[model samples]
Target chain A: MGEVKHILLAKFKDDVSQEQIDLLIKGYANLVNHVEPMKSFRWGKDVSVENLHQGFTHVFESSFETTEGIATYISHPAHVEFADSFLAQLDKVLVVDYKPTAVEP
Target chain B: MGEVKHILLAKFKDDVSQEQIDLLIKGYANLVNHVEPMKSFRWGKDVSVENLHQGFTHVFESSFETTEGIATYISHPAHVEFADSFLAQLDKVLVVDYKPTAVEP
Candidate 1:
């Protein structure tokens, strides 16, 4: 199996400003340094105007070498602190992790 | 100004078998050839034991060269037909799109 990819989709609380979200995104980016299992991290704000999004406006994704790596990242103090401190600012969150499979395209 | 990523998370309906889902996934993989704007596609079954997934069991993501490319893909007949055919088998669906941005670790 390929490496596991952890995906997070979030809609910030109504009062959270764009500036705050930007800073939080940077904080997540820095998590790679604090969490040894974090292989790479990337994030962005939703740009699609499709009504299908259901209000989700931001997404963050990280790659881990294995499922154990995912567990380590989840249990890391930095990740826990980040979630504990800012989770209240999120209105909705959708998280899913998957391992890539070969597919012709 | 980086490429836009279109992410999809879904859980199949109670009656949908894994074999059916696999066929649908392969059908999706073929969309890249039918839809000119589709740059690349990847998908996988969810592997997280984290209760945070909220029952979302599969994810498919595709990268587009531009926001316009996304627009084209959305309006393509192949995409529309696929969604119309398989959407009824999805119990829950979450879709999000975002444009990549550089950030330091």
Candidate 2:
């Protein structure tokens, strides 16, 4: 079975202002607007209205036919630029990059 | 294949103090320490030595026989108490509960 990567999650730094955070997220969204192998890529403000938690600022999902495709995506100049910009405002991030071990039969 | 729930991710509120954040995470970990069907229970400070990102504070992965099991975990009394304390300090959270459409052959 081809590898299927699931989700990418990131958390921003506390010092970053809301406006800067919003701009950083939107700008990165624009950059990844058309990456090959990125089956899906969408992000939004944290939705948890719960008191102590700020939902993850953004969650991006993408799938690739193989692991190599994901590696390339990570290193591509365009992606690096996007990552650099996005990383600037983030203080924390949690990324779980895994290919489904097997598709459900 | 029986339902398979892969991951659970959460983000805490901006105003959360570091001590409180750590306590919240540790407490939740203990609450779910013995739940059946859970394959994993772990949390950590974000790690992305690359500048600008703090990395996700914690990531938890658990497997379940069905979505309902995961739901049960969500509504369990211990979970609620843990969540209440945790949510009390969080500003946002994103929850994605999915069953593997097909386990790989």
Candidate 3:
């Protein structure tokens, strides 16, 4: 019923090269073109001043119009294939989906 | 030069009640009113189908106009005060700030 933000935080393996991570991120961003109901994809590197990030170095967020959209994306062949390679390079990963509720000023 | 998303993932301690969590979230959301450069506040419970959440249960996101804005927020008295009580009730917390780079379809 509302927009869902699929937030994923990842810590790449020490052995993985930056170039490989870039290619993997590119592959992830390209999924919006192949998946349905997935509205957009945005990502960024951690830039917090606080050291509370544990060990996560990157954040990948996918936007969907509905909860069902996430379900579809998970089962879609494109995501499944991408995830297989993506997960292999990550030392740790955390995925969470939330329907954002804005607090008015 | 770009908008930054200050993302925080938190897991409440086992003994904390739902009502207390609600109040904490309310206090968190209210920070926008007192802190400058904090453009918006939004949050949600983890509804992810994937069990990869690693134990994090809630996501709190605050939007800022720039990286400096986030720095200001980190030191702002309102935020620091809120973080004190908020962190006390959390079993774990992960924070990362990122500048969103959109991928065009």
Candidate 4:
């Protein structure tokens, strides 16, 4: 029952517009308000100097307190509905969940 | 300058032993001690419900104060030496850096 990070890496289709993507991102962020178990949402564009991204351009991260929280968020109607529009624009996507473990220096 | 999260997703080759991976992960996390700009490190195995991982099995995240901090980390001798051994065990790897933008509810 530890915290989990749902990390999604996405590559938008070549023809998708920035405006369309922006709107989708806004919709994604708004899910936090609708889904009770989802604690926070953050996202970013790839900025690595290393050319190792394999075409993924964006990263979206969602945090939850436990595995059940993630299960709740994924099955929530709000998330399901939003994912439809979100997936339509993506040419490729990678999603993974992990319980973050701090590494002591 | 904004803070950056350097995210790396890796899939180890089928032949690589779990013992080897454990050692490699230890080396990776220890980079914070050797590299001045790498503030923190954490990692986790994929626990996602969705099968969108594209064969990637683990996530490694490093935090930095700025993009330039990441630049210093990437070029530092400790990181370079570590990455060579790390990459040799991987079948595939994807890396991306991004400035985290919080989405307010």
TM-score of each model's chain B: 0.93, 0.65, 0.95, 0.95
Candidate 1 C-alpha lDDT tens digits along B1-105? 358999988889999988998889988889988999897888988888767788988899999988899888888999999988778889988788888776964
Q: What DockQ does each prediction reach against the true complex?
A: 0.70, 0.07, 0.80, 0.80
- Considering only the true interface residues, what is the Cα RMSD of candidate 1 after superposition? 1.7
Off by over 4 Å in 2: A1-3, A45-57, A101-105, B1-6, B9-73, B76-105
Q: What tens-digit string does per-residue lDDT give for candidate 4 at B75-95?
A: 999999999999999999999
Per-residue C-alpha lDDT of model 2 across residues A6-104, encoded as one tens digit per residue: 455566777888898767656655544545755544453333322223335555545667666666677777778888777676665655555443112
Q: Which fraction of the native contacts appears in each prediction? A: 0.71, 0.01, 0.92, 0.89
Clashing pairs in 4: none
Model 2 chain B — which ten-residue stretch has the worst lDDT? B46-55
Question: For residues B49-73, what per-residue lDDT tens digits would candidate 2 score against the true structure?
Answer: 3332233444454556766676677
Which portions of model 1 miss their true places by more than 4 Å? none
Worst 10 residues of 1 chain B by lDDT: B96-105
Q: State each candidate's clash count.
A: 0, 32, 0, 0
Compute the DockQ of candidate 2.
Answer: 0.07
Full candidate order by DockQ, most accurate first: 4, 3, 1, 2
RMSD from true fold, candidate 3: 1.4
DockQ, computed on Cα atoms, for candidate 4: 0.80
lDDT per residue, candidate 4, A1-105, as tens digits? 568999999999999999988888999999999999998899999988889988889999999999889899989999999998899999999999998897664
User: Which residues of candidate 3, in runs, are more than 4 Å off?
Assistant: none
